[model samples]
Target: MKVVLLQDVAGHGKKGDVVNVSDGYARNVLIAKKWGLEATPKNLNDLKLRTKNEAKLAAEHLAAAREMAEAMKSWKVETAIKTGENGKVFGSVSSREIADEVKKQYDQDLDKKKIILEEPIRSLGMHEIKVKLHPQVTAILRVHVGEA
Candidate 1:
């Protein structure tokens, strides 16, 4: 029996893929679980239209992410940390703090996970940070650390 997968199935096929399986398996495992549908003419047409719509949405989202990355490259984030003599901070700055500053400066929300920090910043100076905006896009963050 031929089936159209509505979602990805590990070790089998991905969403929108048409695969062949035993009649009993399709009926019991896939159809009964609402994971796939029988590959009828109408179902095939629906899958085609769905995939086209998804592709269009993905393209638009990618374009927006690219614009955000470009804007972020030239941006600066200023942070005031508690410092002792010789411009040394009492504590380090984490990715979460960086994410909050990005939002405060540019009004753009960023996930803390997207900020790639090797470790917390412990010194006082200007440092460059790496931010992953998308799988295909990246941004450089300029951090200016000063005494509070």
Candidate 2:
């Protein structure tokens, strides 16, 4: 018996996959448990259409991420830090501060979690920050840190 999996079944197949199993198992374990549906002609066609729509939506999301990365290259955010005598830095700059500064300066809302910071900025200079816009897209944002 052929079954279309509604969810992943260990050692069997992933969701949306069609797998062949014994008729007894398909009828008792899969259908009875509501884990899968019988692979009828209508069910197969619906799965095919759903897959096609998902692929199209994924491509559109990737394109939007690429476009945002291109636009972010020219954006610069200004931030400030407190410095002591002899030019000693008092505090470091964080991703949350950078995100807030970008919104305040450029009117662009950016998520702090998307800003990748290996460590907090401790120096006073222009720094390049990596922002993960998507799984496959990364953008560089310039941040100019000066004394407050």
Give a tens-digit lDDT track for model 1, residues 1-148: 9999988988779988999999998999999999899999999999999989999998998898899888887898998789987775799889999899989988999999999999998888899999888888888989988788
Each prediction's whole-model lDDT (CA) = 0.90, 0.95
Compute each candidate's TM-score over C-alphas: 0.93, 0.87
Instruction: Identify the leading candidate in terms of TM-score.
Output: 1
Residue 5, model 1, lDDT = 94
Model 1 alpha-carbon miss at residue 27, Å: 0.5
**Model 2 score (lDDT):** 0.95
Worst 10 residues of 2 by lDDT: 102-111
Error of 2 at 20 (Å): 0.9
The number of residue pairs in model 2 that clash at the backbone is 0
Q: Find the candidate with the highest lDDT and give its number.
A: 2
